[model samples]
Target: MSANLQSAANPSLSLKKRILPVWNQLGMLIILVLLCVVLALFAPYFTETNNILNILKQSSITAILAAGMTMVILTGGIDLSVGATLALAGVISVMLSNAGVPAGIAMLTGAAVGYTAGAVNGYFTAVAKLPSFVVTLGSMTYLRGIAFVISGGLPVVLQDKLFIFFGSGSLFGIPTPIYIMAVVYIAMFFVLKYTLFGRHVYAIGGNEEAARLTGIKVERTLIHVYSISGLMAGIAGVVMAGRVISGQPNAGISFELDAIAAVILGGTSFVGGVGRIQGTIIGVLIMAVLGNGLTLLDVDYYWQLIVKGLVIVIAVLLDKLRN
Candidate 1:
């Protein structure tokens, strides 16, 4: 009897150990499902296919931006300027396309501008030894101003059909934005999981001094990470522009907050050195679902913002306790 009990306990204990890390990833999924269940119980329209697809479509831009923000945050850094960079990129891309520039060239130009802005943030943080918060905060203001200056505070309408296709078209009955998000996430997952650069990012986030001792080029990696964040912001800008068919100078306001919220809700530690891409995905889904459910229930938008803020605060508090 004693031997049998020990044997059973051994397997159960081992199983528990294996499942510990997975709990973080599973937590978000469980919450999302619970929320959906509640919403479905209360609101019949919550289960509609169109409503679901709209949630996914609306989440596409934020998902893309959050994917990149995950990499940066995993390294114990944040980019508050992503919202401004996104707006700036959208304005530039649409303006260029309207000026008879080729669609491809206009897109590239926007991405380039975003990259440069990210590089500047990285340089100040990594090379100049400034805090990322201060650097990105300054950038947040400056970049938004730059966008207004460039667009003269006017909205830029895109005339290129190809650009609109990226935003509005469907592939095999799925929205193009959904397809883009899927591709970007897959590629980002591969890079984060398999590449040397990805490993370096983890190492640095895990411990910057230790990573330096391990011969990881800490400064360069920081720069590259910020650049990736900027690039994603640019991609998000393009997607948003496509969706709206116009580039508004004030576009993407407070979007950075949403991206960071998604990252945190996905189980990424603000303290640095711990995060999962899969968790981030679930986090994005939760936000999307919450928004969808609210719309279905006809809840006020202001209440939605308040709820989101509370969720972030709770998540960060829980993260602190876990650490």
Candidate 2:
């Protein structure tokens, strides 16, 4: 009874000890809701069902990249090559499709290529002990070069209806990209929550030396983490190709910035070791809402870029506050 009274008398202490820890995740959710409400009030078509679905569809590619990014960051690593890898996969998939390979097979091949790229990143970052930033940066440059070389700095257009449908088709009033996003999110959630790999990821990010001491296959796990990142980018690439009905070498430029921004905005610390799929989803939606809302309001594209940069800055500030 005395303890309860003392606690009640010290609400500041309670808030400091309690409210701070969970605010990182909750702050984004609250901000997202507030943004939605604001958009609904001011932006035409903002709250409409069609526009809502459209936003989800538009966000799918970035969300997919962010999902893979969550895994890489959880392992105290980064992959700057995703956007380039995406472009490469997209061109390769389209090339294969043009060469008479089936659409499904071509898509699979694209994902495999992404996986292969990631494996190389993992090898350098983990086995060769190179910094992830340096390794992925090099990969990013070479991969973009490869894309340009293969595509001759041009876009490859495919005439296949099935290939186009992956990006443009819908099921039960939802876009195909939405379905792909959903599947990717679900699988990521499961992998992060119920698997040893998930645990190891957190452990490594939190403390690599401790993880290595515990006999975890740190190098092998880091490789998988990056490979997964690459594979996700590949999937994004294929979908992007479907959307344009072509593979463009310039596709996904600056996309790595968006993916990394969303992951961090979702409350994943840049310092590593703390994040969740749910937060990432919220972050994805927040980013989508910002772009969609601003466009509806006729904000200039250049200004939108500025706003995005400011939002990232704010998000990082909030992260600092929360931590």
Candidate 3:
């Protein structure tokens, strides 16, 4: 009774020890709701059902990329090559389709290419002891080059009906990409929360040396992490190709930045091992809403870029604060 009374007497101590933590955890969700309310009030069409669905559909690609990125970043690493990988995979998939390959195989091949690229990244970073940033950056450059070379610096139109369905089709009035996003997030949530691999990722991010000492296959886990990242980018690439009905070597430029930003904004520590898949989904939604709202307000494209850059900076600052 005495201790309880003393604790109640110290409001500042209670706030610092209690309230702040809760705020840190929930700040993004609050921000998302507030942003939506403001946008709906200011942008007349923002609350329309069609516009809402469009936001989800358009944001699905980034959300997918961010999901993979969340895993990689949770291990205290980064992959700068995803954008390039998307372009390369998309290009290959389309070219294959044009060459009379079946639609399903072509899509799967694109995803495989992404996985292969990620595995290579994992090899250099995990086995060869190279920094992920340097390794992925090098891959980013070469992959983009390879994409351009293979596509002859031109876009390849995709005509496969089944392939296009994944990108632009809808079922039950919801866009297919949104459904894909849902599956990815649901699967990721389970993986991070309930799987041995997920626990290992967190452990490594917390302390790689300690995890290694404890018999975690640090190298193999990292390789898997990066490979998953690549795979997500590949899937996103296929969806993008389907949406546009073409494979452009230039698709997904700057996507890495957006993914990173979303992850960080969703309250994932940039240092790794202190985030959730649910938080990433909220972050993606915030980003999507911001962009959609700005467009509705008739903001110039250049200004939107500036706004997004500022948001990225703010997200980094928040991560630092959380750390």
Candidates ranked, most accurate by lDDT first: 3, 2, 1
TM, every model: 0.93, 0.96, 0.97
Which parts of model 3 have CA positions greater than 4 angstroms off?
Answer: 1-10
Candidate 3 vs. true structure, TM-score: 0.97
In the range 1-323, model 3's lDDT, one tens digit per residue, is 87667679997776677776897789999999999999989998999999999999999989989999999999999999999999999999999998999999999999999999999999999999999999999999999999999999999999889899989999999999999999999999999999999999999999999999999999999999999999999999998999899999999999999999999999889898889989999999999999999999999999999999999999999999888
Which candidate gets the maximum lDDT versus the true structure?
3
- Candidate order by TM-score, highest to lowest? 3, 2, 1
Compute the lDDT for candidate 1.
0.89
| Top candidate, metric TM-score | 3
Total clashes, candidate 2?
Answer: 0
Clashing pairs in 1: none
Candidate 3 lDDT at 63 equals 94
Q: Write down the worst ten-residue block by lDDT for model 1.
A: 16-25
Model 2, runs deviating above 4 Å: 1-11
Error of 1 at 59 (Å): 0.4
Clashes of each: 0, 0, 0
